[model samples]
Target: MTTTYDPTHPRYDNEGDMRDELLRVYDLCHGCRLCFNLCPSFPSLFEAIDAHDGDVEALSVAEQDKVVDECYQCKLCYVKCPYVPPHEWELDFPRLMLRNTAVRRKHDGLRAKLTDQALGRTDLVGTLSTMVAPLANAVTQTPGSLPRRVMEKVTGIAAERMLPPYARQRFSTWFKKRVTPTLTRRQGSVTVFPTCLVEYQNP
Candidate 1:
């Protein structure tokens, strides 16, 4: 659909420079749809784009809200977008969306504070996981346990999911002892990320 922007928009004033840059970046989007297809966010984003193409102001408050809510913030699109590569670095879509998301939060208010809280605090999760581990294990093993239902309700993680048991010792502590300095020359140094499975489940 053909799109047209209004000469006057509520947020348009004093945003000429930003608007120009956004248009320039929009032109760089080749419509290859590679990132679109990869992202779970595309369904909402595609709708917004289609709406705006017909009329810049056609997007209602609800439509814009839904569009921003769908972004998982995983940055998969940033990594997958073909335009992000090359010497030119024509990639601006992710940044643009981020900026738009900020505008959304400011204007529409926060939507996923609980999810953010849960994802951001690793220490809290680790502490809670260890504290209730025995009960957690039993509930998972037991039939029709309340804890099993509660877990699914709060996080939407399936009750039937096979979660690894917590380790008796933390992996970091074990690694400190096991990791020894190699004095031999011509040998390469190894880097390890110590994934969740290896670090927490099987120290």
Candidate 2:
């Protein structure tokens, strides 16, 4: 079934405000293509925006999922933008992209599926790596294989990409081996958020 967002659709409480803002940013696109030079996804994004109209789904559920997979979650585009609007203004393109991701998640529920199955269960991933790591490496490294070729075609991750070898010991394991006493901070407590990448990626 082909489902599309409609202006009168009851699912959209915010109407097309998000979509309009995104399109507005695209309208402001100077055609300088600064973001294009930063990441592979940007080039695709540039093309999408160049052609996208009010009715098109340039950043829909399926399309956004593809973007999430293809993009390496790099902030290079954000840094390279010449006219990146501040949050106080309503013209932040990066912020718009992040909001688009959230809307996709809220509307389509793909983010939960991806995260719960692939991202949330680190322990399960670690367990699977014991078997899949070698096979993944071989398939990717092999010159002519269905798995290697198919993986490359579907994911855009290069078959010959030099993936890091799985560490023999996990961080917690290494941390447990240390005999040094833990030091307590005498001053203010600090919260180290691992969400920088997440924020940047979606944004």
- Compare the candidates by TM-score and give the number of the best one: 1
Model 2: lDDT equals 0.51
Per-residue accuracy of model 1 over 62-104 as CA lDDT, tens digit each: 6644644566677787787766645364564555556555544
Candidate 2, superposed: residue stretches over 4 Å from native: 1-15, 49-73, 86-90, 110-117, 120-203
Residue 12 CA error for candidate 2 (Å)? 11
The prediction achieving the highest lDDT against the true structure is 1
Candidate 1 has a TM-score of 0.48
Report model 2's TM-score to 2 decimal places. Answer: 0.45
TM-score to native of every candidate shown: 0.48, 0.45
